[model samples]
Target: MNNKRRIDQTEIAEVSKIDTYKSIIESLLFVTGEPLSIREIGTIIRCNERETLEIVKEMEKDYKNRSRGIKLISSNKMLQLVTKPNNSEYVQRLLKTNVRQSLSQAALETLSIIAYKQPITRVAIDEIRGVKSDRAIYTLLEKSIIKECGRLEVPGRPILYSTTEEFIKYFGLDSMESIPSLEDILNNFGEMSKNLKSE
Candidate 1:
């Protein structure tokens, strides 16, 4: 009976540790505002992948069930916290007041291609769009919505472009997977661009 009680106490302690770790991970996600891989999070929390993933899954479930403004989103084994989509209108209003910069049609097209097919080269982007993307790429980089990931191992070692955390935040998406399809983007953003131009 004494041995059984000791085992139960040990289990309780282990559960307590997991709870503490979950809270720490929540704080990290809130502050980072970027996707963090399981490996990265494990290193920071001093836990293994299995443990970290378990905690993250539980946290995700909790956020989903609650009526919270922020939720946890995981993609490609990476995790990030973002405001819920239903709250986008309020956030966009605030952003419009503070941010005067906006993406042009060319810039949006270039960014869409990059967001959908990240780590893509500028040459490939121009080929897909059938036009020069130098100006668009430069604009996106200046806005910090896209960044150079690295050089492709092809001819001339062309630079690869990928969307940044700011892109995810600007779109109010939980993760890259949340990005709309090209058709949806065109249909929806067509209306949006008109509104922006009118304003």
Candidate 2:
């Protein structure tokens, strides 16, 4: 009976450790406000990939059971904590106040190009905009609306840029697909600004 009791205690301690890991991962996701790859989580938590994925899955289940405004989303094996779709209106209201800095027209133009032609290099952006866009790219990077996604497999291996999750939040978009097509924007850039402002 004493041996059985020790076994039960050991099981309980193991469960507790799993719970602690879940909480730690939850806090990290909440703080970062961006997608975290399994490798990134493993590095932060000092765990292997399998262990990190297990804890993340467990935490996802727990969040599903409990009523919470935020939930986990996975894209391309990257995990991100985001407000539930049902709570988007409320989240947008709060975000608007916090994100009051107006975007310049140059920045808007650059951002529009990126949103449509993501994974594009700086040279492509310049070609589209018909001028240098270094400052606009820098501003967007500073605002976290865009991020360096990867490097193009060409000579010089220029950095490829793409929209961040923050971009969706900023535009109150359901997803990247929600953005109007390039044709729509080309037909009427002013219309896009008006619609975004109304949102």
TM-score winner: 2
lDDT (tens digit, per residue) of candidate 2 on 1-199: 9999999999999999999888888888888655677888899889998998888888788779558877887544577776676877776687876533578888899998898788899999999989988767766776789999999998899999999999999889999889888677676988888899999
Pick out the ten consecutive residues of candidate 2 with the lowest summed lDDT: 94-103
Report the error of model 2 at residue 66, Å.
Answer: 5.5
lDDT of each: 0.84, 0.83
How many backbone clashes are present in model 2?
0
Q: List the residue pairs that clash in candidate 2.
A: none
TM-score of each: 0.50, 0.53
Q: Please identify model 1 stretches exceeding 4 Å from their true place.
A: 92-199
- Model 1, position 156, has a per-residue lDDT of 93
User: What are the runs in model 2 whose C-alpha is more than 4 Å off?
Assistant: 93-199
